[model samples]
Target: MTCFGPRQQTAALQQAVPKTRVQTCNSTPVRADGEFVLYWMIAFRRTEWNFSLQRAVEWAVELRKPLVIFEPLRVGYRWASDRFHRFVVDGMADNASRIAAMKNRGVVYFPYVEPERGSGNGLLAALAERACVVVTDDFPSFFLPQMVAATATRLPVKLEQVDANGLLPLRATDRVFTTAFSFRSYLQQELPPHLAQFPQSNPLARIQLPAMKTLPGTITRRWKPVSKELLLGDVAELAAFSIDHSVGVVDQRGGATAARQRLQQFLERRLAHYSETANEPDEEARSGLSPYLHFGHISPHELFHELTSCECWSPARLARKSNGKREGWWGMSTGAETWLDQFVTWRELGYNMASHRDDYERYESLPDWARATLDKHARDRREHVYSLDEFSAASTRDPLWNAAQTQLLREGRIHNYMRMLWGKKILEWTASPRDALDVMIELNNRYALDGRNPNSYSGIFWCLGRYDRPWGPERHIVGTVRYMSSANTARKFSVDGYLSCYGEGTHR
Candidate 1:
């Protein structure tokens, strides 16, 4: 293989990953004599529509080396559980099958599931020792940013982190948006240029490079790839892993395969009613794609493409005005516009904040007015206070809240509308505003599949007035933070069926 100079390498990488989406993590030079290109697949775990993988493939082709994709699951991370592990492993299973089917693709898929705490440590470092260059997902939220940063400093070869998190790159703008309206307006103006920059929908399909038949013996001997049975979703195999078994796996399988199917089902069956019924507790109009999106099993670009194609829409249909008002920007149908608001505006708002603000997940990161209003009402007496245990057990007196919690515990998700009520009730019942925040974080991150994500934090914090404004006629415990009650929710929407579905005695 001919070794390229630093300038040539930089030019090639720029062509592969757009300047807006790529971040050079370290100053280390690429190793000219290295064996392969390593892709540390952390956030964007799927094989398709992934900028990280696309970048890795481009590097492999440029260097005339095979591509090694390392997707690892660590047991020591917070909220490591049977449910999350099973979901991710299912995606690994799908990736393994997909790679196997693509014979001679020159891509090696390595799925590592840490059997115990700290067992998977140093795996990336060991793999990087022989790699020409390392590429990874540039995820801003949770522990990924820190983890990548720490690893970047120790690696001998250059590392590139690609932003595949959303349609708008995380580094596209440095502004941290405080409200959906402002963010929506910014997006309407800024997002059009990025729409044309989608990652390859199937980067692996035409990939051709040197095939890597084996890993270094030291690497394979210590960190063996997960067994075939484990990837096959064997129940007995799952039980043997050391994680939080109490949070049992849900029925929904994870991975790009299931994510695409869910997208199709939403478009075929529920999209027409989405504008009117999405907020209703009883309707199955919501997309239910959050878990998949959170795990990077699917790409927002794929969803947007399918939706626009269904509507016979294009960039030319975009509204000329840059005003942030939600409905008209896309120039699509009412339902499509409504869904895009949540998907692009609201969802990317969280990503924007997470990328710019170090304290995005902290209560202190709330807007000044929100923090002040919450602090003012923090000491106000509560009519009902529940311990975290009581809340976790779904032992609350409010049946609707309990039902939502039950749904979270059993199915790993809550209806979109009910989740708001659930959080507001916690604010109303907990001893203090901070306690409510803590409890919401714990419960949501513990059980919900979408928990521990930027959007999840956005939702949880919204209950304490993060993206919301103070309402008139401030209440006792909630202050000016917008308030919600089960009685009022039931009045506004039919909840009888929702209640019955997740009501007490439904599950242990």
Candidate 2:
């Protein structure tokens, strides 16, 4: 069928864009008769700017079949917790609300948790039995890719995956780079033409499905409820779930509403200072939207749409010179463009690595230079070799590292820059590079709200020498993994001042 209006952003065209583009593979399933369309909502969570959702809707209408959006939350996966569970349930709640309001066009079924063990189950098999086609979110790294591979192989029907996370999908890149410069250059060239038109979501016109008799409870209520009176008690109980229960979920909350509010607040209050303060751990410089992005609560496409409409970066238009009454701003402000660059370029760069590289989560994925340099100093005597216990307890002698750890422990996240420094210090304090990598992953995946994401893995890999170059003469602990010393951070910024804000046990 000829789909029209604005051109649909396909994964192929998206990949052709230079920057982080979201592209649809040729394998993307089409909606047809005698088959229902299934949108396996594994990644992109929101209803807006969602190409995958658009694809699912288009196919559903084409086939005149109802669409099913299935999001299964398995409990025993790595780093599963009440915190993450609550965040996911929040998004599920949002999905239910929106889909329900859409009549019977779409149905979101979470199954109250995955019945299988890991991401390696054949859940899609049953869903796709009579499916016109099955479409899933194309994520590069983590268990998502592996799961996709396994599911695709087992499916009896047509299977397609759509790239919706990055502004430009990593498939667009000709090759991976050791730094962001190459990726940035590519994206800058392709963004204008590709990102010019935002793809519109056409919900299924009319389809009959089961009625929404039961409304999913709110996240706060469903997850055992965290009240002002029970905050301490809830935290204490939640802490018992894991070894490092020190980290607690914040009131920032999760889901579409929270994500939208955070974005609005960032655009209004923080966008002006994003470039300057993003690195400062103490300042709320970031939009704090990564978790939402990771969970698919907010569609990157929607964000791109909103960003393009903003005064700072709206597309230029023809000028009417009669009385100088009508014209496009010759020079659009770069704020939105700058943020978009970060969103698509840098963010997807990480996803590209995670998606394509098998060893993304493993230490061996470090660049050749990083590995070589690290091995050169493999036997370098460590100043302090604390056990994971000591490290986990924040008993390190370095007050700076301790403070960073405490912040992550209390807030479930850390300042973006401080996180890098935090990982580097762990590398230095541990006995071996492998051990350091292990420790970093363990602590991060366990605590940070944004942990276990592509960015999280990419950040850890960066500390262990991915997407970076070896610097200077061989150093002791860091090897080639890009040495980031506390002294260097102190010189680079006010380390003492930064740490003072997230001092030990300081939770607001």
Worst 10 residues of 2 by lDDT: 318-327
TM-score of 1: 0.96
Candidate 1: residue 260 Cα off by (Å): 0.5
Show model 1 residue runs off by greater than 4 Å: 1-15
* lDDT by residue (tens digit), candidate 1, 411-444: 9999999999999999989998889999999999
Worst 10 residues of 1 by lDDT: 1-10
Best by TM-score: 1
Candidate 2 residue-wise lDDT, 16-52, digit = tens: 2122433443453443553457788787776666767
Report the number of the highest-lDDT candidate. Answer: 1
